[model samples]
Target: MTRILLIGAPIAVAVSVWFGGDGEPQRPKDDPSLRISRTAAAPDPLKAGTPEQQRELEERIDALPPGLADPAKKEIAARLVASAENSTLDWRSQYGVIEDIGDGNGYTAGIIGFCSGTNDMLQLVEHFTERHPGNPLARYLPALREVDGSDSHEGLGAPFEAAWAKAAQDPAFREAQDLMRDRIYFDPAVRLAKMDGLSTLGQFIYYDAMVLHGPGLGPQGFYGIREAAMAAADTAAEGGDEKAFLGAFLDAGRHVISRQKTEQTRDSSRIDTAQRVFLRQGNMDLQTPLEWRVYGETFRIDS
Candidate 1:
């Protein structure tokens, strides 16, 4: 059996062969079960080239204008996400926020909208309980688990909501939320965007998508949306135009948002008005003072 791969400037390829006992290449006639594998082994469309190329990409990303990870840019990212999540720039104010919002995910709470119907809220509480023994929300673990996949408030109600609000007051709880947000969303989004050779604006775009869509690898999840975008246009790391790739990425995100069949999910102003505005204005680096609208309300981040 032989495998042949074609290597290009940014893609890799190779070829291999299996010889018979006679030391000659096996053929269909020589062996009925013999098989030949031919494949197009290209570099990951979402990743840079070789190790040295990846290193260069990382350095270039780090040297670019301060990205989402920068203290200022990160704060700006939070505000941008908050505008869509809470309709306010005061992200910290959302720490104590908890409500069902009729989204079918059960109680949506905290800064990143962890939903009880989804497994993330369970993970968030589990993480917090692990760090701080017997926290206010620990007792609701059973109920949270029970309602992990439905909109039922079977075992959680006012008591659970009150406990959540009370837990929010503790600095430790707030810190736990921040840690989980970064662990589950922020860090992975930013890291992947950088590897894709995206600019600061791209990093923010990825983070925003992660916030709205869970980090799941499913077809509608954050990574799936990215994959769809890559299918449309090569990522910057793949030697494609950054603007084009980002535009495709935004389009993919919008498509996923539109399919949810909910009023709130149907409104993709976060990408349409906000991100597209920046993309249209050619703010790939995401340099501010910036202004955009979401849900018909305008927001700004000046520095």
Candidate 2:
């Protein structure tokens, strides 16, 4: 399989030109000269992406043939998620990563590259333990917490590594991974899109960002992306336009995806550019018979 290497490594401040390309200080949104201001009412977080209501996109994704990703929602999302994490999609049957890939300290493993330095890895283990008590890794929760977000695998020695491999074989563990992904990425993106009047396509865009930058606020996480979009236009909750707000959000994501030169990310422009294609085509529902390219390779799904 061709490796996309499409996730993570986002650079913040991809595009922050306020006044001009020249080195100029940006004025506050309320700067009298700029005349930029928030909407009359508060920006709504709970209410968003309402267009998906009429779209019925979940049905469309369900209709896709097997092994085709709608980007970030269904089983296909898990496959693509694996592809993004390990540069391959067929890794569900494989396990044990002892080498550090310059990400999350070292030894990133599993479908989503659970690493010692990443807090999500700890959460994955914890979730697995909760479902299957007395699991080998259950005891390591304390050490996992202690070392969360740190590159140090401290107390997590060979036992933890072996347990990680063992758990991957368990169907329960696989289910747990999916559960964690949904809680952290898929569900939030869908709900947020609903509140913001976006469609499944919008929901997927949010999910992609959440997958890389965490569902919560990292330097350029979902909250920051939403914040950037909010700065541009009022959200649906604020009684502002929906299309305009979504455009702002995608633009912000585009900047982050393009933070490095096109060559560095292997032309990560695939993501932002593909979404732009859908937006232009008015495929808000993300209906299938889809085709797109990543890493200069074309992929399609017709069902």
Query: Roughly what TM-score does model 2 have, to 2 decimal places?
Result: 0.65
Model 1 Cα RMSD, 1 decimal:
11.8
Q: Which ten residues in a row have the lowest lDDT in candidate 2?
A: 11-20
Cα error, candidate 1, residue 49 (Å): 12
Worst 10 residues of 1 by lDDT: 1-10
Q: How far in Å is the alpha carbon of 273 misplaced in model 2?
A: 4.2
lDDT of 2 by residue, 141-216 (tens): 8997787666676888788888877777778887887676666556656554544445566666666666655543
Evaluate model 2: give its lDDT. Answer: 0.55
Q: Which candidate's lDDT is highest?
A: 1
Per-residue error for 143 in candidate 1, Å, reads: 1.1
* After superposition, candidate 2 runs with Cα above 4 Å error: 1-73, 79-83, 86-99, 104-107, 157-159, 236-243, 257-267
Measured over all alpha carbons after superposition, the RMSD of each candidate to the real structure, in angstroms, is 11.8, 11.0
lDDT digits (tens) for residues 1-303 of candidate 1: 000111111111111112333422222343332221222222233343345544543454445444689898899899998999999999999999999877667788999888887677888899899888789999999998898877788888999999999999999999999988887778777866765667889999988887787765555666667777877886665557889999999998888777775787678899899999999999877788999999999998887
